[model samples]
Target: MTIAYDWLALGAAACWAVTGLISAPQSRHLGAFAFTRWRMGLVFLALAPVAWLSGGLQQLSLVQLGILVLSGLVGIFIGDTALFASMNRLGPRRTGVLFATHAFFSAVLGFLFLDERMGAQALVGGVLIVAGVMTAIAWGARKDESHAFESLQGHWPTGVALGLLAALCQAGGSFIAKPVMAAGVDPMAAMVVRVGVTCLAHLLLLWSGVGLARAQGTMTPRVLGLVLLSGAIGMGLGMSLILLALRHGEVGMVGILSSVSPVLVLPLLWLTMGRAPARGAWWGAAMTVGGTVLVLLRSHS
Candidate 1:
């Protein structure tokens, strides 16, 4: 049933929420590029066996494999690194809200490239989603907020720019993979290709002797554990769900559902940080969800 992909999309959202909660400290500890590289390596190691055992690698043509590699480069490598960089500067909650713009990007890209129709209702939903993201970023922080998770790192504008870049890359990567997924590629196999290529790319970057690409902190056993867990849930489970959903669902609808990570992360942040989100956070999350629902309704109609 179509509802099945909806559940998959929601599941991916939940997974990403948990991932963000776990990843904040790790991102801070390792720096964005290093953290993403480590995370991708762990995910690739864990998934390679499963994909090989399932014979999913045999399902792809060279062209499909090439697309998956590009997806990994854009989505996992660049998008993920930008995401964690934004997270390091802006914290998880704010980054999540900004990253929610990917839903709007996905919808528009779907219309332009996938022959997906965007009616008036969907257009309105897209506007609301963008407005909600801007509203949340502008007022999401409280003056009295003293938690590490709420503190700003580097430049706020830079963080915002990185978050938007991550969103665009996320949508672009998914759009690139949609056709391949629709062609009956195995989700696990596709993940292996994507993650493997990404992991290799990270290795090459690290080996290139770029100071910015090097690890910012010493790797501890605790940090390693956190990275592994984050990668397992975030990339291993979360991304596989996206691929599966893409196999059967439209890009816009799947992106809208998965973008609920911003809402889900609020409670997780509250639980971890021992305080509720700022008032603007709740309002922005509400508008985003409302927009998502509107879009879904239009899709069904």
Candidate 2:
């Protein structure tokens, strides 16, 4: 069962990698706030009916519902908006590396708040995984690489700050949700609440006439399609998997497994951009795989 949860986390990582790839251009086009708003709206539309039919919403107590709402606001609303904002400035690869710090944040928070402790082997594996992700992204791009995805868009410091904030909020959100999930809240129902609250928040922000909340580029059919696709896969499916993993898995372990998104994104970038990653990327990927094996083996044992 632990191994199964590990796989679920890995699956979520894969989904998020794809989402990051699909989101880069659209995020730049729509602006981070607008893109997040639109994506959350779409995710809410898609998940609401399913959650209703499943009748999972009724299982939550008022306190649990409140906690879930807060998780949504922090995780989906703020964390996601910050993530894409960072991506717009730093590009997906660098942003991903910074975002990978969430694993450590989650581990620490789990220890402090949830009293979750990892074995020595698992801790070492987590360290290696994070090191590999940072290595792969920090040195991933070639010197002469001129692809838009490799180019920095705005102030690098601002991008870095946003990335770290996103990571922290992500960890915080998971910490908040862990208890509710462990109490046997349906994953889909929990997701609907989180996403629905986030969608409402975004709508409120947009309605407030904030210029930053407005779309930066004209919305086209192609962009809308990409938004819907990324939202469905990343927020809808990916997040649901995370919730499921949290149902039985420790937050630290789930976070460590899911933080492999940066490593996973490498191959997808290679496929989409038609260029092989650097030697450092391969080495880092190898380390990431070894670390993942260690973690999984620890779980099995």
Candidate 3:
């Protein structure tokens, strides 16, 4: 991968990490679903003007529009919703650990659906990444060794399931977006279409699942501002960076870097929480991160 793409991928990860902090307060008050729904809407509202100004709005064909819109729905709407549910259940740190599994998930999905080929290094890296995840979250059995079985006992099945859904959603979105972005539409129009679909999907979700929360009241200005900030960070900024990285380098490289989110999350958590994981979880996190790094290195050369 080129240095520019490396920076872009890393930058995307940082913005996404910061977004977790931004969205936390809003999720606390508005609830995750309610917060995500509004965040999705406001993001498009904020992105639309910029997209228009960039003249990204004027360059769309019907087919590109459809694919782009679908990309948004799959990625932000479904992915974000499932992710929040998983995060709530698993906590950001552990959920992040699961999310680090994204490289593997994408690989699997592509293998099954797209017939993508994985060379030896890529395959090894995939194994290491999964092992790293297992390590990062692993606990112990009677021998007090890191036990996969113990890690499996954590309150994260639903989180893992939802995370898997989010991973697939994001992968699907990225897959669809390739042609759209490559088709050379207005970048802003692309943004608008992407977030617009997210907005609509969130609306449907709110109507169906967040009725009680929605009826509580619209968000306060501060809440809305923060949610919008997160949406900008996540969708506007984070995803944008990913697209840029793809333009500059290999998707496999970017995907591997993305799996490093768990490692990034740990320091963020350590700073935020003022504590480290217990020995087992700590070791698990280390191994998981190391494994991910191994995977990245395997492909990088």
Candidate 4:
């Protein structure tokens, strides 16, 4: 708890950034539904080992199990579903930027449930994040014609609606996770339950609605491998780290730090794709960093 929550949050953000960038290449070959399914499935497969290794499973209680599953359904299942949909609807750049909105939701959630006070730094940081998004995304563009970010504001209604949904689901998922674990659940065990439940949620969605199943791109062995990468990097390690950090720290800080994904992905996009982000991306980075720095300085007060 003594360490800055923002640090762990940043780690989560950076990890997620890498996860998205890594997943993007392979994701191109797969449809969003199929891609997300495999990605989440891999997470469930890996959770068994992680849970056992962490020794969190030994004492897994009913309440803990319940909370974990709920976390999965809400956080991984619903939150990520919305997230990936956003990626399809809006590309990674804009999605990442909009996804940063999770900070506001987390802040509100923290205030309500965790009784965590938002310092002046947190407030100012939140405003800066908004400013950054507005500055960067007001007219952001994506190279990928199919990606939603290309015309996000042009179809302002759809993009804003989906982003808000993703933000809410993620925020709710984060809010529910802490108290459950803090009530004495081990973080690793909690993750296993969440991932497993999330997997089921996807499965159920696929079955319940033909539209979801039909939405998928063809799933072949090659595509499956990429999904595995997504699970390993994006869900398994990244999510586990998030659970650990949230268990030990406040969600507000996590939210603030998590906002870094938009900024973190820029360099990677440039390096890997030989493409610089739209000018809006750079401005977003500055504001996100500035807001994050506000958290750092204020946490000292």
Candidate 5:
């Protein structure tokens, strides 16, 4: 079961990596906020039918619905806001490095709230995983761009604070959803509720003239296709896999595995961009894999 969770988490990571590729240009064309709004709306539309068809929606109690909604608000809404803010302040490379702290935050919060304990091997593995991710983000950026170091010129303290808060909120949101998933709620049903809440929240923001109140450009076929692809991979499939992982494995471990998106994205980028990944990127991938093996091995032992 735990192994299944690990694989599911990896699948989720792959989905997110695909989303990044599809959405980056699309978001550039449509503006970030507007793209996100459309993406969330698409995810809701995609998941709602699945939930209904699978009878997952009918099995949820009111309490479970509430948990999922809250999780969505915190994880999707608030967490995303903080993440973007941090990115604005620190830029992508620094922000990516900071965002990797989410796994550590998830683990520590799980221990504090759920009393989940890890063995020494798991601890070492977790640290290595984080270190590898950070190294990859920081070093890969240096190799990939001449202007990468320029992104570090912002208010470091504020960015760091918001980044950490985002991490905590993300982990907390996942932790809150675990008990309901453990209680036999279908991951798809939970996903419907979660995505529904985020969609509603985004709509409210738009309605109130708070954020992404209008479309950035006329929706073209290319933009529409990219949006659909990104939403399907990142939110529809990626989020469902995450919920399934949380159902079958500890949230902390799942978080760590899912955080491997940076490592996973390397080959895809190389293939698409017609460039080999930096040596640092390869090292990062190797370390991430080694660490994951250690964590899984120790957990089962």
Candidate 6:
């Protein structure tokens, strides 16, 4: 089950990577907060049947309901908002490198808060995965002329601060969900609760005039399709897979695998961008995959 869940986490990572690749341009046009709100709304609609088939809201206790809602707020709402803001400040490359810290945050917080511990080998594996991802992203990172990097000159500190906060929120949200998932909550059902709450929170923000009100204007057919695909793959499936992983695997290990999206993005880049990855990128991706395998093997043994 641990091995299976580890693979599932990896799959989730791949799905998220694809989501990032496909939806980035659309997200830029729509604004991150607006895009996310629309994407989650789509995800809510998509997951409804699955949630129903899985016995959905009926499966959760009052405590579980609260935890899942909190998890959604912290993870989807706060963390994602911070992440998009960080990307706006820092380029995607810097933000991507910073995002690698999430696994470390997960490991540390899991230890302190959940009493979850990784053995030395697992620790080494986790470190290697993070290092590899950072290397891969940073090595190939080019300046995006589109984002007006010069304008962000003095704002780097703000980006760094927001990036760290995003990482913390991500890790913290997972840790908060860990106990509930371990208590036998179905991952699919839990996802429904989490996404449902997140959708409502985003709606509340919209109602309060905090979120942008240009959903109809910004969503072209192409953009809407991309967003729907992203929501289906990333928010709908990827999130549920992570939850399933949390139920069956160690938090640190699952976090490590799930955060390997940058590594997974390499091949996609090659295929789409018409350039093979640099040797450093290849080496980094190899190291990340090797580390994931090592972690899974150690768990199995």
Give the winner by lDDT. Answer: 2
- Arranged by TM-score with the best first, the candidates are 2, 1, 6, 5, 4, 3
> Model 6: clashing residue pairs?
none
**Candidate 1 residue pairs in backbone clash:** none
Candidates sorted by lDDT, descending order? 2, 1, 6, 5, 4, 3
Distance (Å) between predicted and true CA of 60, model 2?
1.8
RMSD of 4: 3.1
- lDDT string for model 3 (35-150, tens) is 77787777777888887777777778788888887888887778877776666555565566566566665666556665666567656655665566556553411334232212
Scanning candidate 6 in windows of ten residues, the lowest lDDT window is 142-151
TM per candidate comes to 0.92, 0.98, 0.79, 0.86, 0.88, 0.89
Clashing pairs in 4: 89-148, 90-148, 90-149, 91-149
Please give, for residues 1-301, the per-residue lDDT of candidate 6 as tens digits.
6789889889988887887667656655677678878888888888878778768668789999999999989988888767766766664556666776888888888778778777777778888899899888777533442333213533788888877888888888888899999887988788878888878887888888763534524568888898899888988888888898888777777788888987887787677666666677877887898788788787445
Say which prediction, candidate 5 or candidate 6, comes out ahead on TM-score: 6
lDDT of each: 0.86, 0.93, 0.65, 0.71, 0.76, 0.78
Clashing pairs in 2: none
Error of 6 at 244 (Å): 0.4
TM-score of 3: 0.79
Q: Score residue 35 of candidate 4 by CA lDDT.
A: 70
lDDT for model 4 comes to 0.71
Q: How displaced is residue 294 in candidate 4, in Å? A: 2.6
lDDT of 1 at 35: 93
RMSD of candidates 1 onward, in order: 2.1, 1.0, 5.0, 3.1, 2.9, 2.9
